[model samples]
Target: MKIATYNVNGVNGRLPVLLRWLDEAAPDIVCLQELKAPQEKFPEQAITDAGYNAIWHGQKSWNGVAILSRGLEIEEVMRGLPGDEEDTQSRYIEAKIAGLRVGCLYLPNGNPAPGPKLDYKMGWFERLKAHSAELLQLDEPVVLTGDYNVMPTELDVYKPERWVDDALFRPEVREAFHSLVAQGWTDAIRKLYPDQKIYTFWDYFRNAYGRDAGLRIDHFLLSPHLDKRLLAAGVNREVRGWEKTSDHAPVWIELTAGG
Candidate 1:
């Protein structure tokens, strides 16, 4: 089965491009981020017409996530990341489908570091770490996929030095990501293309895509049970070139049947 993650930027504005990609890629399951719409504003009918059943957590004008499954039952397990009852952003959604526990998240961007935003980002990371550890204890086939918003390593960035101090590439942020993967989860893309500079996102400014200046922020982290099932993975790079497309391209992975 194939699973993919895409940060749509603004789902409504990019609905056409999204539908087009869905038609072409035909992934069995998809995790979408950045819906930028309210709960009642999600385009459910349009997505349903594309032959997928979906469950989404949406917030107005920013941060939302959703999971879509093609012909499979999507049993929503959670709408928000656990451990933070006061947190209200719609940044996570988890579901059970095809015998797999799937988590879709949009980690906070945490820009203008050395401030409250960065503090919230780190706090959220801590919560994620706590929750992820619990998920691992379940010992099931699990895949946490989404626009993580952190580059994770120098190799994941186009120009290492240029992004050193940026929120997404800051040392602490990358360390947090590495720390997450260190908990026995396989970074699927890196596992397949160890040394390759594979990127999943490009900025809309400064001719980033045209110059191939990108970052591998979106990712899939698989639990031990599904590690050996990983077969193939890639970035649909051309999708970034589409008119009005998101800065992020679709990142996908193929897994063998029966993990």
Candidate 2:
């Protein structure tokens, strides 16, 4: 089975590119972030016409997640993280497709750091860690995938020092991310391309994409069940160069089988 994750930036704005990639990549399951629309606003018929069944958690003009599968029934599991009831971002959605518990997360890109946003980012990480711990105990096939926003390591970024002050590359933020992987989640991309600096996002500024100056923030983490099933991992870079495209590309993995 082929599974993929993409930060679409906005579903409506990039619908064509998304559709094209979905056809070209042929991922059996696709997890999307930054839908940037309410649940009712999602183009249900359009997606269905393309032979996909989807489940989405959406908000107005920002932060939404969805899972799309071809000829598959999606069972919604959870909507928001478990840290604070007051925290109301549509950044997370869990679902079951083909008996694999999959989580699509748009982790906070806490900018202008050393402030409340950063604090919230760390807090959200804790919540994810707690939730992931519970899921890990299940010991079933699972995939935690999306634009995690935290760079897994310095090698994953272009200039580690330049990003030192940013939330995505900050030590504290990365540490919190590390805590999640420590709970028996396999960083699937790293497993395939350990030393290569494979980038999944390119800024829309200063010819970032043209120059190949990008970051590898998007990820796919598998549970122990996938460790043996892991077959391949990849980043679809050509999609990022399309007109009015998202900064992030699609990251994907293939498994030998799934229940």
lDDT of each: 0.94, 0.91
User: Backbone clashes in each candidate structure, one number apiece?
Assistant: 0, 0
Q: Across residues 87-191, which tens digit of lDDT does each residue of candidate 2 receive?
A: 989999999889899999999998879999988888899999999999899967889999999888988998888888888998898888888998898999898
Off by over 4 Å in 1: none
lDDT of 2: 0.91
Among these predictions, the greatest TM-score belongs to 1
Candidate 1 structure quality by residue, lDDT tens digits, 199-245: 99988889999999999999999999999999999999999999999
Error of 2 at 183 (Å): 1.0
